[model samples]
Target chain A: MSDGYTESTIEVAGLPIQVLRGGEGPSVLVIHHETGNPGWLEFHNALSGSRDTILPTLPGWDGTERGDWMRSVRDIAAVCSLLLDELGVADVTLVGLGFGGYVAAEMATANQSRLSELVLVNAVGLQPEDGEIRDQFLEAHADYVKSCFADPANFTDLYGEEVSTEQLIAWDANREMTARTAWKPFLYSQTLPHLLRNVTVKTKVIRGTQDTVVPAAVAHQYVSLLGDAQLIELVGGHNLESDAPEALAEAIVA
Target chain B: MHLMYFTEQPMSAYDEHAAEEGVTALLFSNSNFDPVAGSQLYNDRLTEYKLAEEVGVDGIMLNEHHNAPFCMQAKCNIWASVLAGATERVKIVLLGNPLPLADNPIRLAEELAMIDMISGGRLVSGFVRGGGTEQLATGVNPAYNRERFEEAHDLIVEAWTRPGPFRWEGRHYQHRVVNPWALPMQQPHPRIWIPGVLSRETVIWAAKHRYPYIALNTTIEATKRIWQTYDDAANEVGYDPGPENRGYLLRVHVADTTEKAMQNASQFMWMQGEFTGLAHPVWSNPAGYASPRNREALVEVMNGRRPPPRAQSFDNQIENMQIIAGTPDECIRKLRTILEETRPGILALWGNDGRVTHEDSMRCIELLGTEVMPALRDIGAELDLDGPFDSEPPVSISYDEAAKARVASAAAASGD
Candidate 1:
């Protein structure tokens, strides 16, 4: 409709953050992934009809500014809580990516009364005793995240040139920022799973079966740890929200 | 079809800043650039080339490549045709078409002549002996590379110049007639540019023919050796390898000041590093061009012996690559120095380098058009550029029209 979305910059706890708001109806605080832009509002407009969604550009992602003291996961969660307060948005259905999932976990633990529902799409907020978070897809098959849906030609048409070194470095920095705020002993357990008992919100964990970054087995463990959380295995990988937005749309609406 | 598209993403503000000093903008392509979301990189380059006319560039240059990311196009003719269709007021340059590797030189000749006629004669036909991995994939014999290239060159020239139906059978080529109906639009032929990497045969040949010789980007020392050979050959032929006859493509950028230029140029430097420092060997011995001299040189150039100067960024990489990447004042001084050192009639500036933004490139067009070009006018006239090709009328309609016309059954089966 009006394109995916666009955000106006707002200061929360003295930090300048780009807050993406789109769709209509009940507010869903949607935190986008790294490499994701506000252009996603076009997709949201297509799905929600009149449902309103909110996306916050996390600090140091793209060009958004982060506070010097915003260090750990708990710190980011507190900042987001303050951000919601400034926006007068209470009890949001927290949506997140890898680092955003970790922030969502921390927010669910600290502000239990604020979240109505949670959607973690190919999220990475869990730990596994088996292998490390398999980021194999990043280095190996970085070509196609939607090979099943279309063709390599379509992906190139959309993605253009392979991401350059500078862009990659910027991406790496964003991930490190996520790690700084969320990673700790045993990964997602720092707040999630243990905090799962208190998370009364309608939570759904949607993952791509072929996601190399967060293995499907690890996602299964994530669902097992949560109480009454719905789990969905779809087509696509880590960036499945964008890659297979239709499948994700079906998962979210269903 | 091997397609070679030159990604000449220009840096505008920097170019403007450089232009103030009466210097041309430098261009280059980024090797390691891919966006997670949006258009493909080479397509972006095509779009830039298409706009080269409005951008006021002297020539839209392209080169050859295989696996390395520096150049995406293996065959430059495809992009040349695309450019032929897209821009009207800029010279179309296939900075080189490697002659030695082609199994059919006639096809190459036919295509280039078609482009020359198509562009209404504003084509700069560049011939070269392809370097690096191309030699390997094409199965050319290295030892006989020069001979094959020269022979092929002669055959093609004969085809272009010869007026009619004459039989030609040579060591590597045979044609029933020297000339076909698809003659070039130009009275004689489009100007030819010879891009020499390290080939002495290329130098001697260009000098003998008085064709413009452009040295591919290399060390000053290496370039000096090439110039020496070219000059000596010209002397032997009683011709002057003067300013109009020699040129080089340097990676350059410009900005308001030296510091600003350096800061803005980091991406370009990084791109150069990626292009020149590919893990794959840049030069290799392939089957068709089996020349002993070529094979040895290929190994050396591909083995990473070439020392590329470092700049802070791509913007500065333009400067360090012997392009003028400074304020107008500084750029003018640098241009003067390079001109004095090389004494070439043409200064082919490159504004596109790795990771250069479209906005910057557009600015370069403005800067060069309004500033630098005016400065160089004293030395040379505005380049002889023509308008883009006219679209062919619909063949379907014409064919239907012809079909509708009755010919009285060919006058009772009598052939007319």
Candidate 2:
């Protein structure tokens, strides 16, 4: 819901991906959660207050039709890399949340040299040794929405008035793609921590203080995995972008 | 019109009412299982198959499911071996072995070969892409379900017909030494029968491969549409597909009276509910199991476009002919209508499920054998519908035939 934010479609690996691009300063690449982008929400508004935001609707969500041939997180990382090269965006801030966070971590693993900074919000790339990732796929949509926020929002509010059939289709497409990519080894890759050993990007692992979808220990896990990573425990839960966007945006730029 | 006796061999001894109390069957909770009873149930199922053979069913179909008491027949091929040993005349139709879930296709080939040998070349090998529920159960990447199914099937067939001691490096599977000591009887391999739901890709794949496409337990209209998809695909390749290439699995519970049959139908309802998500949507539709398009259709079904399977009354299923019930005569009439509609040569009769009593299952089996089956055969003759056995389904490769070619190539290479 912000002005000066423009949207366009970009082709990467033969599939068209819808991307939101705008801002006046440094470039920031945003990969959305399993539920797809929250549109140009308040988080985007604040995060891009003085910087550019390059948010692509991940394949199999919203306006982006998944290239079924590309079904792995590693494939997604490749697409993001192509997205960067296509936009001539190097040394950009990479912010990913939940499923997107997994993709960001993967990208950093492959080539963090392209990234100026890496921010993961309630990231799901690492399975915690002490606890397991909550089974979001098994939860009721209403309950899932509830678990995503500390002060839970009504399902109606999250979905807006009377969810459209198209909206439901988009949500399912996103979930299926998430399942295809994340179901094995579950929400985290078994080899990611070992892969992250080589990642030296200025990485930040941000967790909502009460995030239930991802355990608090996982934030620490992410920090431990990266060579130079910081942990930022923030207010709200899994979906801090929607729960407390202004604060999340501040933390991203901070 | 060939009647194939089928059962999930369900361990349905638990309080199905426990579903309301939060017990799940998909990737089933072991707590609900009574091992003592399971032992008996397993024996009873074996006997049921024996009875099916004695009663003159053309074939017997065993399906596989995991973590679900829904189908205790987890390894259909293992049961196929037992059935092969037990039955004399009947074909051991493994309706299937979930190909995508198997980590070793060569092992599967060996096992099927053993069954084919044990049964004296009566194995009808069926391959499945596996259900979405298997995504979580097998922990196989759901994204690679289709790929794994296709690759695994190819690998198994290659292991059977292709002179192995070779190597296979494919996308989803890699075998350094693609060889197996045990090779299938009946030359190349047994005829392949592929079971599918409403997925168009599966229908097309089955058509392209000339495998008999058995439409699983869906409505008449859905089954017709699925058959149409296969027929269209075949027609595109200038092939006129016959009933022999089409199969249908119908959950049929019959008794002496309609009341007894309706009561028994509750078992299927319990399964339908859990599967359709009336008890829980997640049981059947755990995310990523299906394509994005299929998943959306499931969401719409829950949103009231169609009642969740759990909520459907037995009466509704009967009305839709999704489940064929009632007396032998009534069942005969309903089945005839389905036969006319779908025209599947391979008719898989799902005779038992859920909390349906074993006694009722046996009686139903008896009635199906003595009464229902013979009547159906007459109709089959009248309709001129022939299954795989009636008209031998073609196979592309022959191990002995191919072996001769391999020997020739080896001699030529030696420059002798």
Candidate 3:
């Protein structure tokens, strides 16, 4: 009884990108956090009722092809532009979660014409001074993982009886994806805040107040600095979009 | 050789009730979530396993997959450890350890052997080269997967059987001072169940050693060919392979009436369609066989192209017989037909895939156990069938007193 989405590995300019899509409405191009998995059905199900959400797993994440052309965040931004053009979705809301928020900011700054609105949740595109993005998910500790959820009871149904090797591999894959995208000496770009000046889209920086990865102060700065942006904090952590879909839905709809 | 499909945690009361039926086996594939969260999920799974054991299920199963948020348990070894600590009677089947992908098979061998010992002797071990997407994530060369599997098997078996301190050498694997403790409680090794379509290597190995081969859910035409291949290979080798050597997997659901069953199964069918809808054409195409040997028999499969098989009606009961959905009588008839024709010693059913509710699945299991199994038992008795299978493959690990001590110390230190 849930909304569902389907995806395909279309060779866009000879590179295999896993594109997720569901519903039939004005297309909303979705970008994933650095630690994204192949199951976009959850997000697609959440957003499919109103508009088709096209979630494309970033290159080098989830076994997608990392074509030579994709060198930096700008390249990803360029690819998002091409993807929007290919799907023929115009004046769309560019939704990004975590690292995806960085991509949304990039698109808003460089390719603002295609984006009608931008939504960033627990985003990481710039450095922080007071606190740091905890590497719990990447580190794969049982305790840190428990803290990520709003309801710990959901862990068993979502994770299974005990952490099987399959679960470990699944988590490892997520870490691997993060490693591929953000494993350099400094995870986020120090120069990204400067890039935020050019983005003039109607932006909403939705964040989890307790999210270790992207804290509130950083989000506040992005909201204050952007030409037209607002910040709304919620009750979950980095993966709060899926955890608190009601709040997220309102943010997107607003 | 009992076959079981360990289900996800029962979402409804009906599924909980169904877990109590004449179900001899249960499988629970852990979802991909964090381990701390998994401990909570594990309780739900453990409840099912403990209930199934209490209801006299012959075996319980676990499997592994990575990074799927929908499922949480990713590591079967860790899962096995937890299950070993909790349950006592039901046989534990890992179904596979994906030998080729594991960076350390020695650790896997030591761990599996320990699990086997800890669970008294009820461990049905299965080895596999794993699937494609997994290979991609593990960075394993799909082309050399078979070779890697073979090599790992040799090393694990060597670690199990050969008495202590020996040098192990192989192309894909190399280990020094090869010593593994905690041999399996089952004489020789616990039973080995090989699951897949008819691969030449698997069939030959299973036949040569008389291990059970569980054919995964495949078309009737394909099953027939696979059976014939096993039969032909056994005959050529001048061996009379027993019925236990043959088993087929089927997705079945039987309700009060054929109409009810169909109605319940429709959502499951839609789930399957929605799940696989985005895959490349090859994955969704039911009619086509991936290998060359079975190309000619491809046309016999009902859903070759336009009409997706999972979404289609139950066609020619004999031709495309794997999808068994109907009233109890209808299901019993299909089960009887398969048992008679294939003469398989085992019939493993998975009536829940793609949104199949717990109620429907439990109903199917209950009907099969209450009505269908008794009928099959009568038929088997009439045929003068032998009792349940007892032949087990040889164990690979054996432990001396010192080695046992080492294992005990290791297990204690690791808090296993």
Best by DockQ: 2
Q: Report the Cα lDDT for residue B407, model 3.
A: 54
TM-score of each: 0.48, 0.87, 0.49
How well is each residue in B232-349 modelled by candidate 1, as lDDT tens digits?
8766544444556666665455554577555544544434222343323322332223233343333333332333222244333353445457555666566555555655554566
C-alpha lDDT of all candidate models, in order: 0.58, 0.79, 0.60
Clash pairs, candidate 2, are B27-B67, B28-B67, B273-B310, B277-B280
State the displacement of the C-alpha of residue A86, model 1, in Å, after optimal TM-score superposition.
99
Docking class of predicted structure 2: acceptable
In the range B1-416, model 2's lDDT, one tens digit per residue, is: 67888887767678766554444545346777899998999998877888888878888888788777767877888788888888888888887888888888888999999999989999989888777667667777666778888999989888888886999999878888987889888776888888877578888988877788888787888887887788888654445678888888888888999999988876786663233344455545665556656766677654544555554566787888888888999999998988888788889888888777778888999999999989888888888788867876565323224434655676788896
DockQ of the two-chain complex in candidate 1:
0.01
Tens-digit lDDT string for candidate 3 (B286-330) = 111123243223222211223323324435432466567888788
Docking class of 3: incorrect
For model 3 chain B, give the 10-residue run with minimal summed lDDT: B280-289
For A1-254, candidate 3 gives per-residue lDDT tens digits of 12366767655666677787787677787787654553654545667778867888776665456664444565677777777777778979888887788777877777788778888888777776557766432232334455565666655545655644443433434444444344432356766788788778898888886676665677887887799998788887777765777667666766
lDDT of 1: 0.58
Worst 10 residues of 2 chain B by lDDT: B395-404
Estimate the TM-score for candidate 1.
0.48
